[model samples]
Target: MCLAVPGKIISIHDDGSLMKMGQVRFGGIVKEVNLAYVPSVQVGEYVIVHVGFAISILNEEEAQKVFSYLQEIADEGGQ
Candidate 1:
């Protein structure tokens, strides 16, 4: 199985063009992700990321809820 987590889009390339990269915060850690699919994603938005790419966008609250639930599951050591 594969897991793609929700992360906050901290910043998109100021150029706002194709071949753009962005910063995404997940589990309180930030990482660079490719935004080639959604080249228009803006800062402060959230996206679901997998394998170094942002696949889709989601709201901040919803992303946080997912994160919280995942944290709970991790704390439980899996089911």
Candidate 2:
């Protein structure tokens, strides 16, 4: 099964004609995403990213909680 991970919208850069490029951040890992489906996203907002597109928006606290959980899992695995 595929998963749409939650990430924070850190920046946006339109090409003056289309909403097709921007940056999203997940735990300091940044990636390019398609804004074609989500043309209204802004910085400081959380979004559910899937296959280079943002499918849905998430809350700030919820995003942080996800990161916290991942950190915990990584810590456990390292032990």
Question: Against the hidden reference, what TM-scores do the models get?
Answer: 0.66, 0.65
Relative to the true structure, how large is the alpha-carbon lDDT of every model?
Answer: 0.85, 0.82
Candidate 1 stretches with Cα past 4 Å from truth are: 14-18, 59-79
State model 1's lDDT. Answer: 0.85
Sliding window of 10 residues with minimal summed lDDT for model 1: 58-67
Misplaced by over 4 Å in model 2 are 59-79
Expressed as tens digits, the lDDT of each residue in 1-79 for candidate 1 is 4699889998887565666899999987999999988766888888999999999988657647865996898989975
Question: What RMSD does each model have against the real structure?
Answer: 8.1, 8.5
lDDT score for residue 25 of model 2: 89
Give the Å error, residue 20, model 1.
0.9
Model 2, 1-79: lDDT tens per residue?
Answer: 4688888888888886665677898997999987777777888887888888888777667647865997899999999
RMSD of 1: 8.1
